[model samples]
Target: MRAFVSMLSGILFGFGLALSGMMDPSRVRGFLDIFGDWDPTMAFVMGGAVIVMAIAWRMQKAMNKPVVCDQFSLPGTKLIDARLIGGAALFGIGWGLAGLCPGPAVASLANNLSGAAIFVAAMIAGMVIFRLTERPAQ
Candidate 1:
């Protein structure tokens, strides 16, 4: 049941990405192009996501445990650290360069096979490097 729900959520998210044009690198690049032909489509998509997430967070706080889990698994730290900053900077640079973030890159794999494949490969490599270098939680 939990697996089914997870699959459904992923499918809905992928469908939203496709319908919102987030799967298109050109459209994403246009959204980032503030000084040029800037597109506001992505902004609307992000706004909607923020709103939905805000509501979800509120509901989460009201719950003692998740519907399909023993307890909610969430980030334990709220600290601002060098590792976080560096990772965020790297992510931003990659997004600017390819105009494809991890979610959309994976979701668009079928739409742009070669480009998405390269992006996913690089993304996985980065993740592996991070895992290899990261210190164990104290």
Candidate 2:
């Protein structure tokens, strides 16, 4: 049941990304290109997501356990560190250059097989590298 719900949610999210034109690298690039023909569509999408997530967070706070899960598995860390900042910088650079983050890139694989495949492959590689190189939390 939990797996089914997770799959359904992922499908819905991918569909939303496709409908919002987020699956298109050009649209994402336009949104990031502040000095060029800037696009505000992604901003609206992100704002909507933030609002929805805020409501969801409030609802989650009131619940003891998730409908499909035993308990909520939220992030434990709250402190910002050098690794976080460095990872964020690298992510921003990659997003600016390729105009596709993980979610959108995976969603885009249905339409753009080659590029999305490459991006996903590299992303996996980066994750592996990070896992191997990162020091255990003190």
lDDT by residue for model 2 (28-130), tens:
9999998999999999999999999999999999999999888899988678888789889999999988989999999888999999999999999999998
Clashes of each: 0, 0
lDDT of 2 at 136: 85
Best by lDDT: 2
lDDT of 2 at 34: 89
Encode model 1's per-residue lDDT on 1-138: one tens digit a residue. Answer: 899989999999999999989888889899999999999999999999999999999999999999988989998877998878988998888888898999999997978999999999999998899789988987
Q: Pull out the clashing pairs in model 2.
A: none
* Every candidate's lDDT: 0.92, 0.93
Q: Model 2 misses residue 98 by how many Å?
A: 0.5
What TM-score, over all chains together, does every model reach? 0.93, 0.94
Return the clash pairs for model 1, or none: none
Q: Residue 73: error of model 2 in Å?
A: 0.9
